[model samples]
Target: MNTTPAFSRRSWLQRTASGFGALALHDLVQAAQTPLAVKAPRFPAKAKRVIFLFMSGGPSQPDLFDPKDYIKRMHGKTISAPINTNELRVGTDKFLALATHGEVKPRGQSGMMISDLLPHTATIADEISLLRAVHSDNNQHQPAALQFHTGVTADVRPSMGSWISYGLGAENSNLPNFITIHPDSDTRLYGASFLPAAHQGTKVVIPQGDKQSPIDYLADVSGDAKAQRARIDFTQRMNRRLLKGAEVDARMEGMIESMEIAFRMQSATPELVDISNESEATKKLYGIGEKTTDKNGRACLLARRLSEAGVRFVQVTMGGWDHHGNIRDALPKSCSETDQPCAALIKDLKSRGLLDDTLVVWSGEFGRTPWSQDLSGTSPIHKHGREHQPESFCTWMAGGGIKPGFTFGETDDFGFRPVSGKVHLHDLHATILHQLGLDHEKLTWRHLGRDFRLTDVYGNVVKEILA
Candidate 1:
């Protein structure tokens, strides 16, 4: 008798396929569980955290940091446009030299040039390393900001914070590794394109009113902790089942991980955000209750708190620097809104002994032109504003591995191009990664059959600015 027992189709398939499925499932579960867990750096790190104070809409470099006597003397006069012959010129076709809005005097022992508009920042000039010739490729706001955050000016890519989060992971398991406070409307600025979604920046807002929550949809409406847990468990099981069948779905895997994080954050985040317990003196230092500095002050204070609590990358976006017209009247308002809060953050970090390992960077996407642009063509020289200039800008870095009480880079007499120590956006990205113990060349993610990096195959670490 051919005594082989009749094998059912279901049993045969299960027996043959179950082992492979189990192995895949096990790997997926492990990854989902520890996606944000802290990872060892490739080398010794100088900075444990990064606080990027992004001045959106490009601040004016000439009016703020790199003032030129030539430009001031030739104010309102049509000077020879040093712009590239190939480049397009619009409102700035006249190339009329624009004077600084106020005096740009030497500050601190380093003689870093700072505007009278930023009095608070001037006081801490000794603590900063000023880069006078930071340049980017784009002149437009959206594209320039994109380049600043994602390395590329056009295509969507992982943001700098996302990359850092991927490289270092979360120091505090209860919080996200990357947090962007009051970010721009563009989600691409914080998105973790192609990389694991868990590495993306978590958007946070400083509550304006007593009733508002810093993060929306954070409250549990079910009001039953046990019941919520049960629902989450059920959802996770289904997600895992789907993942196991698919073998690999990065999006689904990220969803699984993010859901768990959201659940946990409900319990851990509220206390961290609450500022009622903060001392009055500390609040005053940040200008928290004051009218002019209230919004950014709260945001900056929150950034410090988040960083101190082990968040790897924290960003505070302060907008309204886009002074296309009437810059003389507009620039000081912008400076007043941001100066004190930003300076206070530096001081607070130093007081807490966090400054040594905390990298604080202040910059815009690009700087404004030294030439005036009068849209009406009838406006006076004082009323005419500057145009965008991508050739050169000013950026300042404090703490981390930077040389304090020093200035690096230089601009030509026109303040239109870098004469020396030119640091491109790529170089800036590379240097930031280097300070965090990440090799820019080695810290890459494979996407679309090739490796991609923050510097995008072009960047040299600016070693001269390093301490």
Candidate 2:
């Protein structure tokens, strides 16, 4: 009865449904074509870009930024056990108070307490806002780092850089919105889960040799730009034909966009990664030629360069701060490798007048305990190191809308817990988003029928630290 003389009802409905699908596919194709195109912020922004200096292993706060008088007085003696009894620890059962390996004296006009191990950082103490009681939930490396980047410790979620990339897009169309230099092996630290894959951070390495490309497989093996373009055009046509037949394919669209970016990057990235054009003065400022600081110095310098070139977010990770034995001998080495490069980044940005619109953050996942921890259980007091402490740590922010020369938060006498002005990692994430003109609560993406955000239903901006 349905096929009385012509087309069946089922065939007609199928044809009409395909036309509707094509209409939806058109919108997705247009969006993928310019995914990184710059978008306006929700409001006026104090910072246009962000540079995150990630200290991978937990850096000791008592040894680097905070020193407690009570802990010093009770050095080598048993103090009240402030840690939870349920938690298992390798050493530090005796609760022997560990004094700071070096002195932390007041520096700059701000009277910010800094260690002698970071002389370069001390020089810029007046330009930074030191947060002495920053806390997080996890103690393990991977999960704590996940919390630091994704706000939740247990699940895979969009990272802060990826969220920022989604929010503001990119100021430079030729480059990615998010780039991480020398990141950890874990991809989750910079992943863009549940978001467009285009927002995922592009990993880069500072080339050790003259001919090595900073990005893997960057060199065009075809040897002809015209031939490459022709091949890409053909491939894109095939991809679009495949996309037209699908209901929805965000990953397919992302791959299309990524391939285009990779083609464009073949021309744009080489000049940015080459540091030879930089002046001798600039090179020396970052300690580029020195053997002790060469690796990190190159990474930091590259970060500044990329930031200046309009990359929305850049991260540089420096590790080796996990000290469980012979801390006095080890902590200084870690400091030496990173101190100058980090401080130089601030100064270089300031000199270029970029600091006013750039937010620079320096922090680790957590901090070390004030009590001695000897994993070997046979080391002396001076040789013993500290255990992981997620209760309190130090994080510093510079430029953007942050108040320079200001110090916020305080910890208990034992340096085990926050006593005042506690700023959780969630709060830090909120404040950073706020400075960039994104309300942490409002910048969200819908997934699985619920709105997800970087702060995840928590976080309050610490107004006192704002300029």
Candidate 3:
């Protein structure tokens, strides 16, 4: 009616923004063109995949990696220690002294002091980079666990694995870029909040006992392949019709992509989880047949298989580490449930030549207190367990860019707090991203009119731990 061709919104934006809008348009075009295809990293990548062994609850560090001989000296004495929070209400002034439960001896050529409780892990001590002074802002379990996965504790955000998946995309198109096996009940642990849902982890819960089906309803039971395809096609047509007038939503696009992935996964996921093809020796290696180790062993073995099959990130969680009392019996059982399988995972990865490019991380939410909860001079074996100590803890990394057999950071004589080389959770996230050739500062997503990153606004790559 105006007798002139109408200027498109994109054209109007480009004409009014003094050329800045063109750059924004270019970025949008690039993002659309290469949504999830494998792309080159910003720099050379050392690790192609990651296997995170998340130990839920807290594990005491003094009895594990950072042993304190001085704690033994003042075992039953009341010592003045710093308590930063009023939540515990233990009065920051003085607390009862507690000593290590087991002997901590030098392991491997690195001469790192590892507890006797983790003898299996100690065997591969030379393959790990132990961070003795790892600390977190939160001491509580859910918040700390959230902080470990996402940078913030208060809000639902994309996880580190999700960030990696967003950055690297899926290696095997049939498999998801991020996979979480036997994760905690909390879905936030592997959720991709603001990021595209395609990057969200595909969760696979391992059956606890005697149940073999890893994913229920994975296979089509209709027994007619052609009919199933026709049904899927019809459903997709309806979805497309619904999507026709939407504002080019990424979430809807991601949902469509996810549906396609699920369709493809029908053929791929079954083979990935099936361990029947694994050798008997391999099963024994992972302690799959043993009652004490079977659950976690299956998880670790599945993680290995997934990693081998080119899944970008795989997380395996082992819970029940929160020991407020009776740590003597509780700690050993925790170790026994996980130690053999974890060690076997590393060894299996190495033997299969996948360790070089597969980075493995092992850590808990926080460390335990240096002092006991109760002051009564009880029996040595029955002494009350330590409380949560967020000020200092330890975590380890192996393979890829990590320096083998290295122990970085330090804690005080009594393992009360960090003395030097304190590695914050943000820094750890940054370092992990760096090892994968992603710059923490540059790997960002624009959300809520601001750039959000996995490390948030804070992170320093711990170069000292790099190989």
Off by over 4 Å in 1: 1-33
Error of 1 at 420 (Å): 0.2
Select the stronger candidate by TM-score from 1 and 3.
1
User: Each candidate's lDDT (Cα)?
Assistant: 0.87, 0.87, 0.82
Error of 3 at 385 (Å): 0.9
True-vs-predicted CA distance for residue 260, candidate 2, Å = 1.0
Off by over 4 Å in 3: 1-35, 84-87, 90-94, 208-212, 241-244, 375-381
| Decoy 1 TM-score against native | 0.92
Off by over 4 Å in 2: 1-33
Pick the winner on TM-score between candidates 2 and 3: 2
> How does model 1 fare in lDDT?
0.87
Instruction: Give all TM-scores, in the order shown.
Output: 0.92, 0.93, 0.90
Model 1: how far is 242 from its true place, Å? Answer: 2.2
Clash counts for the predictions, in order: 0, 0, 0
